[model samples]
Target: MEAHLLPCKISSDGMHVDVQAGFVREETDSISFSGHSVQKANFRGRPIFGTKLPIPPPYEAVLAHPTDSLGDKEPARLFVKSKVSSITLWNLSDEPKASDKIPSAMLWLKLAPLIHSDVTYSN
Candidate 1:
């Protein structure tokens, strides 16, 4: 899915650099920008939501690594986990300000294409 990326980082054994992260958002009947989770909130409770979290594309999409990540599961998953993971004091300067509505850039992430049996390593 396509997303506007907040200022963040991406690393791949030094093969890649200057990456940003953005939460996947979708226009939905349930929520709005900076919105609460759809499954957690009700229309009655928050009729004017901001960006609503999307259901992760598919089970396979959530599990498999992007082809660019060499289909390496942990690294790809870690890249994703970093989006929600808190930033360090060192990283805070690079992060998007909480007041910024639009992100610094956009990125496209492929849907996951693997299953548990396909993973060669695990945390």
Candidate 2:
């Protein structure tokens, strides 16, 4: 799989990085974020289910909405320790751009209510 580090902007909470998975887009496969530690998370918007790393990545996955109409929707969220110095996403077909600004509050609002509160959510 071709991997690339995307240019991401940092928010108060975490960084925003866009990754383009060039080859691996199967409905059942999940991507792993590797840094000082490795974090495995599904690209779907489902709540995170695992332990939190003290030395976290520079960005947190808030949502992982699919960009295209492939009908393969997978929203994900991640947590970074501080500002994102860099970002490397695996299984990417092409290089992706980065942004420091977070997505619109409305988007979060739209998604927050949809997700079940019982589901564990952390950043």
lDDT of each: 0.29, 0.31
Q: After superposition, how far is residue 9 of candidate 1 from its true place, in Å?
A: 3.7
Estimated TM-score for each candidate: 0.18, 0.16
Judged by lDDT, which candidate is best?
2
Q: Report the lDDT tens digits of candidate 1 across residue range 1-123.
A: 323222235445847443333222233454322243222212223322233233333322222233344454644333342222211111122222224433111112122344323657778
Regions of candidate 1 where Cα sits further than 4 Å from its true position: 1-6, 14-34, 37-52, 56-61, 66-123
lDDT score at residue 64, model 2, on the 0-100 scale? 33
Model 1, residue 56: what's the lDDT? 35
Worst 10 residues of 1 by lDDT: 84-93
- Candidate with top TM-score is 1
| Model 2: per-residue Cα lDDT over 14-47, one tens digit each | 4654445622233223222211232233334322
Identify the runs in model 2 with alpha carbons over 4 angstroms from their true place: 1-35, 45-84, 92-123
